[model samples]
Target: MRNLITFFILNLLCQSLTVNADELTVTLLGTGTPIPSIERFGSSTLIEHKGKYFLFDVGRGATIRLSQIGMYPSDIDNIFLTHLHSDHITGFDDFWITGGIWQRANTLNVYGPDGTKSFVEHTQGAFSLDAFYREKQSSLNLKGLEVNVTEIKEGLIYDEDGLKVSAFRVDHGAVEHAYGYRIDSDRHSVLISGDTTYSENLIANSQELDLLIHEVSVIEPKLLQSNPKLKSISKYHTSLQQLHKLVEKVKPQKTVLNHLLLIGSDETELSHLLETKFQDKNIDVGHDLMTIHLR
Candidate 1:
């Protein structure tokens, strides 16, 4: 009877640990493009796990959305970038400067592609005056303002305290080394496909993804005919049609359409079109500050 009771207690403990191990929530902080929208901000996502925060792609207005969630610039110590596009990295100034002034003790750990270090260096140089002003005013630590950049290739970049982040290369048109990232914990896994056309690497890595956040564009026939410029743009991004094919292959538990570029069709129209194609799967358009919990 004692052995039976011990077995029951041990099983309960194992179940509890498994459930607690992968507690995470993802929030779409910004979901707009370089072409501004009042409703949507730029491209940014926040992953919050066990009081620690990780930011992916800090685009315009990311700090504002972060504010909505009660998170300040200093709260996010780790940031991962998919590529070095202007729209994606524009929030660096807000994050670094605000954090530098407010919470100077924390450090910003940035991970990205080959040019990441150079980009951070130049950005810091641009904000040299601001840093100097803060330094003169207060004896703040200013360490949080310091960005530690790790330029990554197609492999594991971060693994600490039971969470793992892996980076893989993807095709984003003329961009040389764009990437997608897979973040895994004990009970849940997520894949973030930062602006890409279509990637075989993404499909292979996403077999176990609980949630997949991917960039998508709308390419309607009328839009292409109306604006010749869209033809060039279409080559660089994944259309709703292409995304349909991708979702069919990856078959994630849930798929989110992010970095949405609305050319001719509005968000509502585009969503209905995509939903028709993905009738068998769960898919939704991402909006700023939308949060999803993964258990």
Candidate 2:
């Protein structure tokens, strides 16, 4: 009996070892903001690990971009939302109704910070007519149209099969409970800083992570001077200077900028500015559809 138990343990260890050799891929499905852009879409990210697909923040055009990446809306069952911001969740209806169209039979599991339940409930309520129409007029499975919303706090919200996700609080101006997420798999770990000002909580949670994807905005004095509203907005989002300090503290292997607000400079210029600040560190200005693989 003891020999059999030892053999089972060995087999499990070997399986784990083999799994570690596989790569986890992160695809930036959309890297733009609320502002419309032909070159970029709103904020959505897809993390594919061990054949499982997890999505974070379904912004505008998320499902369309997912289709572009060879994934149907029905392929994703688990979605984590950082906040209830319009830009972050505008694509919810698209994903929901479209997935229904594609015969998604599984319940959509959505996780988010406090107020998420109300947000989703209201959203579903708003889509009641469309949902009812689809159900009556089409053969789509309305069961998958059902969303299971889970409001999360600053802790481990999900853990299964060596994949874990933790949520932490972030300051988004007056928004009380915005969140950032840390995703840990068997081999790689990543943190996504969903629209936030520099938070010590984020740095503490993101220590030595494989990748840190943080939001950043251009901080030009003239632009801020000209647009008082943008200046106010800047207070809620991280400036390049603030990002430099945050990156200096957290020190992830690679840092990618997302939710870019290009008020002063273009993408290349913004990337150049970031590179100059963190000369020794690896930095990439995120763009839509950019895929990074972690092995």
Candidate 3:
């Protein structure tokens, strides 16, 4: 199926934004959380501005999801990670290794939190033997196998050609250095809420945005009572109730909910409830490969 439901999902939510080629294009390459699902892939997003592509959080199945949207792994030259969670970075090996095989154009550019440089080095070390034989191939581009890593903290990390990428810290349980990203290109902007739970810093950075892609988890109250571990995990992400108020306060021109954790609850009814209550807010649930064009 063609899962890039930009205009379709927008219309269903009682709002719409046109596809403008000369503007920023955001594709929800994978929208699943840590849990595996056939419907959703994982937490990955692809953004293109001024003929350059950037990826955020290449979780499991990211490379396969990218292929579904007319993009190969080689297209992902730059990647920004939220945290070093296993689920958030599991697909990196596939993206990095397979992308090199597909003939990438240049060195891998990776930006992440404190341990980013170490992570990149370790990934290379773990796959040295595989990368060695592949590098020996005469047909391959040697530069594609090289990597450039930047350890990011708060404030601006990337600024070039009217595109500015700013990282802001967010709360994700014990994950001390979790971050939410705000990307601004020309007059348009979008904020990607990486995994978080009631983050005031995220709210502060989310003041003005054309689109806000947020992670949400709706665990049934009874489930939390029955399973203590579930309760602990619930603290790691924002609930629909919290997001309801969040969308109202932040008030982005459009909001898409991804990385859903709907345990023992009806997502359709709840999503509809939120949609009806905030029709003017232009909010919708994100699925894998859903692309939103911003002008």
- Candidate 3 TM-score, true structure as reference: 0.89
The best candidate by lDDT is 2
- Cα lDDT of model 3 by residue, 1-295, tens digit: 3466876776765532223433899999888877888888878999998778999999999988888877877877789999999878999999998888888887888999988888888998998888777767655666677889988889999998778999999999999889999999867999999999988899999978999999988888899899999999988899887888898899899999898888887678668767677678788889888889886
lDDT of each: 0.87, 0.88, 0.86
For candidate 2, write residues 201-252 as lDDT tens digits.
Answer: 8888987799999999886789899988988999999988899999888889
What number of clashing residue pairs does each candidate have, in the order they appear?
1, 0, 0
- Model 2 bad stretches (over 4 Å): 1-22
lDDT tens digits, residue span 41-139, model 1: 889999987778899999998888888888788888899999999889998888778877777566689999989999999989998877788778786
Query: Weakest 10 consecutive residues, lDDT, candidate 3?
Result: 13-22
Residue pairs with backbone overlap in model 3: none
- How does residue 119 of candidate 2 score in lDDT? 80
TM-score of each: 0.93, 0.91, 0.89
Position 56, candidate 2: lDDT: 97
> What's the residue-level lDDT of 90 in candidate 3?
91
Number of the candidate with higher lDDT, 1 or 2: 2
